[model samples]
Target: MSKWAYSTDGFDRIVHRIDGVETVTYAIGQGEPLVYFHGGGTFHGFEWVRPLAGEFRVFCPYHPNFGESGDAELGGMGDYVAHYEMLFPALGLDTFHLCGASMGGHMAARYAAANPLDVEKLALVSPAGLKSDRASIPDFSKVAPQDIPAMFVADPAWVAPFWPADPSPEWAALRARESAAAFASREDLSLTDRALREGLKGFDRPTLLLWGENDRIVPLGYVPEWEAVLPHAELEIIPGGSHLLLDEFPAAVEALRSFLKG
Candidate 1:
């Protein structure tokens, strides 16, 4: 029997195919749909966001070529948007709350701007894609293995459960593969992509700009640009929060709950 067949933890995994490419998503909770897009970092699964299951049916799908998803020829982030064009309908995401973190936030922003789907509310956590001169994204490719986790969170201990103290060659290889996938799919990687920012100029929807005040990856310097593009969007910054604020701060979850409720 499928493990999901008898499981009752409000959790289940689904393997769905689109145009012959298979991607997996972990679903939890029981209510309206809330789709979360992950960042460029190594995605193991939901952590702090797991508590959200109590309120909505959260679907966290591994981007194609990342996590449990099968490989696909991705020309750029546009291709990722196209993938969701097919995947959303397949998964019954007609009118759902949308949330994306890090690189996932970039995709979510693009999708929300371009697609006419009913995104009741959009939540972006430390979104990338907006060009910034004052603060630049550090090259994770060049960062030493021992010092990488600190870039994602204010404290490194938060990631201890996910990353082994001593990563194996296999782990390093996986990180490289994921990094390559993100770099190749992103049309511009110098943290200077105006395509998404320009696209957002016309996007006037209820949005939540959630960020950690101390996010090292995408610094708070990008705030003005975000506010300019999404002038009507609400902004919530957590004190001493990191890029992975969703996992590092419980206040982040509470803020999400309060925003998603409205």
Candidate 2:
């Protein structure tokens, strides 16, 4: 087993094989099901979903090629969407609330747009999909591993837990795998799919767009594009927040709680 395979309080760690890919999932809480797709570099564990356990059963899955999850034969966003199609049924989830961050947000949007009926509600935190002529996503490939944290959060301290003073060989290998997975997912330079934008217009499901006002990776300027595509989406911009707004700001969780409940 990998060093990051253990379960934490309120979350039961389990592995499920869906379509030949073994997926690591953290199941927590009790009420309605809330599937959470975490951001990049969060494959170790889901401390962010711990607070949401009070009201919902949050299932955080490590996407294929990330963490302990087995790699899929295919690549691209569609392959991921298809993986979840098989995964949801194996988990006995017919319909559930969906929440995703950054790259996960991009996947959630594509999933929800394709299977609107399966998603009761959708929450995207600083999502990466949706192209804006004015706003540009930073080239993470060019960023140094140590300096990458600053690009995600407004405060550098938020990433201290993930980056140890002296990382072991195993830890470094894990980080390398995560970085590779991220790049593989975006083989096409265009992260935002034009088809997804059109599909989102027809989603009609209750949607929430939570973003950091100061996000450097996926700028705040893309909010209008998202709003334009998802006409009914409720938009909330966190002040002084960056790409990792949910991590930097606790209020985003409360907002999510209220939105999910409402």
Candidate 3:
């Protein structure tokens, strides 16, 4: 059976082909549809979103060039936004809740801005894509492989799931692909999109900007730019949380749940 099957806690993993591109999708849970866009990493499924299955039919799709998903003719973040616009409808999602972190968050914001009618609500967790002259976002491409874990969370132990005990060749290959995709997608302004930043003002959806107070990858200084553009957005910061605030802090989940439910 698929790991994402309709069991009590499993997600149904399937190969969904959209526009000649084969994408891997994982779906589980009950209630309204909620799509999750993962950050820039070897697309390992997030365990933190499992609890949300009780309240939402969660759909997590590995973006092209990530995980088992096949590569596409994507050039930049704009291509990703356009790709999802087609993928969502092809997947029978007319309108749904959308959430994303890091680079995924950048995609979510642009998508919501472009297709406001498609998103019921929006949640951005330590999202990248906005340029801030005041603060510099760390260049992950320059970060050493051994020190990448520290860039994600304040506590190194929190990255236990990411660090494989038995480092297999397959695992290493997957990480390399993810890194390449991330680097390719963000060759401009270190992944910050001026167009997306300017477009945020047009998005009027009920949006939540969740961040880790101590985030090192995307600094807290970028919060103001997001807020200035997204007037309807609510900013919530998790104390001691790093770039991966959602995974490191339970309060982050609670905050998301409360916002989504409200």
Best by lDDT: 2
CA-lDDT, candidates in order: 0.81, 0.82, 0.81
Residue lDDT tens for model 1, 14-126 = 88998778989878888889999998855445756678887899988888988768889888788898898889888987988899988899899988877745688999999
Q: Which of the two, 1 or 2, has more lDDT?
A: 2
Q: How does residue 98 of candidate 1 score in lDDT?
A: 90
Off by over 4 Å in 2: 1-7, 187-191
Where is the poorest 10-residue window by lDDT in model 1?
1-10
Give each model a TM-score.
0.91, 0.92, 0.91
TM-score, cand. 2: 0.92
- Per-residue accuracy of model 3 over 228-262 as CA lDDT, tens digit each: 87877999998888887776788998899899999
Which residue pairs come into collision in candidate 1? none
Question: Best candidate, TM-score-wise?
Answer: 2
In TM-score terms, candidate 1 sits at 0.91
lDDT of 3: 0.81
RMSD of each: 3.5, 2.3, 3.0
